[model samples]
Target: MNRKTLVLPAVIGLLAPVLAACGGSDDGGRAGGAITVGTTDSYTASKEAPAPLDPAYAYDAGSWNLLRQTLQTLMTMPRGGGEPVPEAAKECGFTDSGNERYECTLRDGLKFASGDAITATDVKYSIDRVLGIKASTGVSGLLSTVDTIETQGYKKVIFHLRTPDATFPYKLATPVAGIVHPEEYPRDKLRTGFKVDGSGPYTLRAEVKGDTIAKAVFTKNDRYTGQLTPKNNSIELRPFADADAMGAALDKGDIDLMTRTMTPAQVEKLSSATTGDVKLTATPGLEIRYLGFNTEAPVVRDKAVRQAMAQIIDRGQLASTVYGEMAEPLFSLVPANITGHSNAFFNKYGAPSADKARQILSKAGVTTPVRLTLNYTTDHYGSGTKKEFEVLKTQLDRSGLFKVEIKGTKWTDFRADGLDGKYAVYGLGWFPDFPDADNFLAPFLDEGNFLALPYVNSAIRDDLIPQSRREADRLIASDSIEEIQNIVADDVPVLPLWQGKQYVAARDDIQGVEWALDSSSNLQLWELSRGVSG
Candidate 1:
């Protein structure tokens, strides 16, 4: 799931089983043209409605994009037509010196839906504001490498960095760089629960937060003059609280698209349930899952204990039992098909062997009383997460070397607890910065490693990162990545569980379903359409 290069989601075609729900008496009009998508995570309106829209403080990807409508970036994705182009800025090449300064120009007539000209001041306010509010949650980490962001003019933005990071442009492409409304938010105060005001194609129409249901309906902004080529003219994003409930809604034909959490069996149910009418397509995604260790923990400080734990987990059984066959065993931090990735951890610890695991812990003098608490998120991923953790507890307990205790928390509590290094060991899943190896490396390997594995690899932080980001040649980049992998293996910070697979079901009549790209499963939204069967 982690990768060293810009990669898209893996595309896995569906193995469908025709079922009752997806099949029904078909009338002449194409299967009720509107598609109903489902997801489990319930969305909430932070009193500000979407206030943290400030790029320096924006956290979620969707809200970032929505607010980006009003803001602008210097460059965009798809070197030459990757997919839907962003509004705001046009593409330009950076200096090969890696991290060398560069500039971008905004397309003519671009302005906020509010009629405010998107000048460089807005860009400066969005980026520089991040460094100003670094103390807030996730803001500092996102703004770490940003040395300085300055505006040359109304349309041009210049970024001078503390390091020569060639990947800065791509980072800008992420929602993290989504422009913000300077008129609405102030830099000093991290605005929370504020409505998102952007120049994007859609505007926040309404919100419903009670009962843990948050929904935002958007309509075309006549004032918008950006790159987002809208197809449907409007979209509605609704967040559901439960994954199973969301799945049921999809089966009952309540939404058009579903992206969140779904087990393999449930996926199979949807694919089969739809028969040929409900199309299920998978894309290689930047979405990644890993086991994180809190270095502050005494037991985990021992290399043998960590190594032994890495050795005994059976990914194959775990995937099938909990995630179903949809989950694949992940061996490396960087995902497959991405550059700068290596299975070093897998090379160090092969298949499971509890007997051998016991010996390692015993040799390390970790007596029977050695107890490890495994933390699991009750609501973040999906329904089977708790059960999966229970299985992990069983495996570790069966070893008889260490007593394992299982703990569960909702996503909010889990994130706070995990970030504070409260749990000795926890699980993490990443979507990616921009589907690049740098994203996988920078966030995890930099001075402040996320898992509380505080590793300060000066070479990686200073030399390797700059060198890799600067080099365009894939082969040379591979060498730098190999070095990074070697260092990761030597340190053994995290164990890669598996690259998760997502199943998306749409009506057969829908066209332009590329189901590709490993970045984020958030489709272009513009690429999908429904009409008469071909």
Candidate 2:
């Protein structure tokens, strides 16, 4: 998911500003205690996201974090991350040898939060509405391969695919495939407002301030008939404007847990501090940051200019100085931890070298001191963004082969400008829709990519991507995946920066802090509970 703004496809929108203290008071106890969770993320009901929580429209992690609590998908990832497993469905699998047809049988006596029965029709309708709406900010692109959905009787649903896509089940595990009641959500338009009517682990009651989601209260849904069982009776999610504000809330006992968008300073303090009751848990993250070039732009459009910039930027210094070593220097579009990952960029560029950058520009017959404008969001991706860009500008300037100007704007305008191709180069972050190499590469390199960049590579997009998706065994797709990375490294449409680590800061008495987030980094609030001594 796009990290900070509305991502066009399966990208996540990161943290935003919202009211901090608006949820229910925390009731202290053991397992069933009401847990208060805090984040800096916010979602607004706008053209980009007409319905902040509608399964068909909400594409940001903040919205998905809440949606996963109230909406059940046909399939879901296991708690610690693995293959897609049956959740609402009793069984699901590819019905054809070509992986073109998928079928699922609904569990008996399934019911929505409103007590309405969840049938195969609801499953078909949920997917159909998502495809029909085709919201630019929605994850409809994830289901583009599906030709049509067919329902048999009241329990069986089948999907006919236009192409052989073995990754379809992983797509189903995402919030984009979340089931919505037919009566609550419309057929062709997004259902607006802050209410949810699905039969997930929780029933939601949210408070909104204008377009900002101030707070959300989740009560355990007694009608939920899924594999997950709630560890707590209730949960209260509060949103803050920044890391400092959220850290203050945690320090003062205003929140039982704090996660998503924790600053490097905050993580360092929590790691070293021995006086406070706070504890920090870090996990290998799928979140990645990169520099996206507008291939049609005047200056960065030149392959030499893009290559020179890539050759000069120092990822090790950037990660250590700016992120306090919380993030790892990334060389490939796919994260290092994910299968089929490769160090293609590192293999080509080697260490950061200005001499090599000058030679590449010289060989391409491009004039020296090429001018470029780099853009980034001011409020998104934490407070270090400005400093990050400042450091980037310094690095490019030091090369003596380029003149770089960095600009900052609010996330809404920044995203709009980037999509409109207003900058020569801009920074973007990705939180995967699913944990796969395809999630990282396909969304950025494919035709009509989420980045809105004019990067077109027929071999990688038309052949390699489809080839990889056809393999039921993802391990067998490594050759195709590696070839795609090499092509990306050569084209230089987007330069990989750093891969971040997921951090959750919670009170020492909080249980299951490590298991609160799923593979795609979506919060599973049901896993959170108070310890016996809490």
Candidate 3:
């Protein structure tokens, strides 16, 4: 997922039988009550009003969170970590040895919230629309492997891929593959306005203030024929400008539960509440925060300069001083819990050394006191960014080998500037699209990577990554991640800083706190409830 957006994950084994046995259980509770959630526009279903309520066009986590509840995909990653299970599909699997062809048959008696019959044609149309519209924010890239999509009558849909991709099913679980009403969403244009025609467990009704969505009300869709059933009859999403506002509402009981917008300070305040009114639960996340370099920038282009910068920065100090224990030091692009993660940066640079940095710079003929500007978003990344950069500047300046200038902007502008290659050095954070090691590759290494930084390592982009994607066994594919990490360490295109843990702070009455986060770190609102006191 884009640093500007948030996304999900899990491992796989047997899927078809597991889904068949589990079928969906609504045993915990009967639908009643209402859930009011508060979050920032950063987590909204659409980045802007009039952008379309279509899931095919959504690119952010807030939107995806909503989409996951309201739109049924062929499969879905269940809460807490496991395999992607059948959701809309009764069964799905690869049809050939190449892993290039896949097929799925829809669950019988399916219908959109509009009462239109759901069929294989709608599935084919939804996938075709994503690839056809090709919106800048749309997830068409998730289907890049698809050569063509064919449907057989109203039940089966088939995908013919350009090459083998074992992770294809995981992609099917993402918002990109969300199924929409065939007649409502146009084939070539995005459907506008605040309302959505969907087939998930919820039907959306929204309220707009001026040009932005002020509130969204989701009611249980009685027509939904999937495993997940709403625990509550209605869910209200209230968007705020920042975490402090959201936290205040939660404290005042204006909102029953809160999901993605809380900042560190707000989290601390709620967690340490003397009143014991709020509770906090954390999910182990695959999110990684790092500093990226625009290799085309005149000041940061040199490999030695990048290496020197890496040598002088101390992640341990940054973690304790700037982030507290909210994050832990990350020495590789891929986090430690994942396979192929190695402390390559640590092995090459050792401990922070100003003297070593200076020696390396001098050997490369870089004059004393190299100068550059450090960039970050003041709010997009949360409340600690300003201090994080301040600490970073101090660390490099104290070395006596560098002089630094710091700059900050809000998320919208910062993302635009970074994408345009305006920053020499900038901070970026990623919430993975999927949990596999391969996710760490294409976004940062492939030709014309998501960074938009002018970096195309032929050995990595052309050879290593493509070779790795062909391996169905992730363990075997992980061998390539080691080589990729070592290459990135040498190239220094981006420096891995820390990996974060997910936090959900809500009223003590809320239950299913543990299952709210799927393995990929995406919020599962369907799992949430109130008055359970769990």
Candidate 4:
């Protein structure tokens, strides 16, 4: 899941005098004619602490969104959001077979917000810095295939890959590859403490007020020569306590737009109500909610028990009762509309049946009334989590072959403890870093993956995924995905639940609602504008 939207730090109190000196308006809604966006700081940081702003260190969605605007990558996800297009680079493409070598040319006369000359050396430095720092939670893993970086004169950069990875360019489109003025940013360490010098469409203004860092303000970077043009002159992103507060603020026009914090009920209310005050725009989302099994746990370690649980759960009912129509039943771990998606679980199990579950358990010599604990996060996921878990408990308990216990934790503790193997079977939701079957497969199933679950299926970990990565043709790569899902369905490492739809709510006068969410489901604030009807 994307990190909760970050709230303005307490130091924002200090920006008043500075903003006032600049003749800014009194209301936070309009800061010197800038669009004000409100969201929750829920997913902005790790469970342990507040997020850092350095593009190399920042991992949460909130920082990433802000970074994308303030830091221009070599390639960027366009407004409609399909393939990554040239941003700072004149052009980028692979120069060798198996996608082992990639090359790009820096656009001439490109300059940073600080007026520093942009060079191919800066591009190499930016990428090497990410690889060198190697933040555990950062985007460094996306470029793990990169073996070395080479530069030719002032405009050309080349990447030699240790292994073929077709998704390398897509990685460049992310904030991890955001080029920086090498002189301003240190090569050995992360440049923390809230100062940014980027070549993107926007620039971030942050200052130290007493002991705390003030809210970072984003304004148009007139120096940018990229494809993106800011619709608003400035933007102030602030965080709310919850979705209800955000909705109220939007209704009152305190905020021009709200992204990534609304509940399904809020979407329904905003869509159904004829108040004509707010508009709802839905985007295709690759978000997948699933039940992950820790293979090391005594109770769930048995493949038969996991398969039995997978066979008994009712997804259609969960979608209707818990999620309404906001979600659809997901039969495969890979979301629908993506290549290599198959209804493998649905095909294998057919339907929820206690008889089938019992037969599977009996054949595996597992005794009846198998004891299990199901875990979920109360805060981070959504308001529907409690109800959804209850439904899961009911379905499993009714099977008579299992005794289930439900446990709930706050998101921070849940995230930390889940990775530490605190829960035997826990619920997880995935928001893709990139729009590919690889994003879905790699993080969860790859060896030494972030999932932290000891689910190492040899054929999947060692063979299928690596083979799929080498195949450039998405259609051919999809065959491996089909086989991988079938293996998951048969092994039952994780139970595929439901995939969700994305919705962004804004006032009637807000334009670019259709383009607000990229194809990857990341909220694009640059696409928004006021004084125009959507």
RMSD of each: 5.8, 6.4, 5.6, 7.8
In angstroms, give how far residue 267 of model 1 lies from its true place.
1.6
Off by over 4 Å in 4: 1-32, 41-52, 181-197, 205-216, 532-534
Task: TM-score each candidate.
Answer: 0.86, 0.92, 0.88, 0.87
Error of 2 at 44 (Å): 2.0
Measured with C-alpha atoms, the lDDT of residue 447 in candidate 4 is: 56
Order of the predicted models by lDDT, top scorer first? 2, 4, 3, 1
Clashing pairs in 2: 1-11, 1-12, 1-431, 2-11, 2-12, 3-14, 4-14
Residue 280's C-alpha lDDT in candidate 4? 68
lDDT of each: 0.61, 0.82, 0.75, 0.76
TM-score, ranked from best to worst: 2, 3, 4, 1
Could you give candidate 2's per-residue lDDT for residues 1-534 as a string of tens digits? Answer: 001111112222222212122222233333445789998887667654468788887766778888889999989887767677999999999988999999999999899989999999999999999999987563677888899999999999999998889999989988889899898889998898898989899999988898878989999898999888787788999989998999899989999889988888887777666665666766657889999998998887788888998899999998888998578899999988788999999999999999999999999999989988789988767888888898899999998998889899887667767778888799988888888898898778776567766789989877999999999888899999999999888889999999887778877666666677654678989877676432
Candidate 3 C-alpha error for residue 104, in Å: 1.7
lDDT of 1: 0.61
What would you estimate as the lDDT of candidate 3? 0.75
Of the candidates shown, which would achieve the greatest TM-score relative to the real structure? 2
Any runs in candidate 2 off by more than 4 Å, and if so which? 1-33
Candidate 4 lDDT trough over 10 residues, lowest sum: 12-21
The number of residue pairs in model 4 that clash at the backbone is 5
Candidate 2 steric clashes: 7
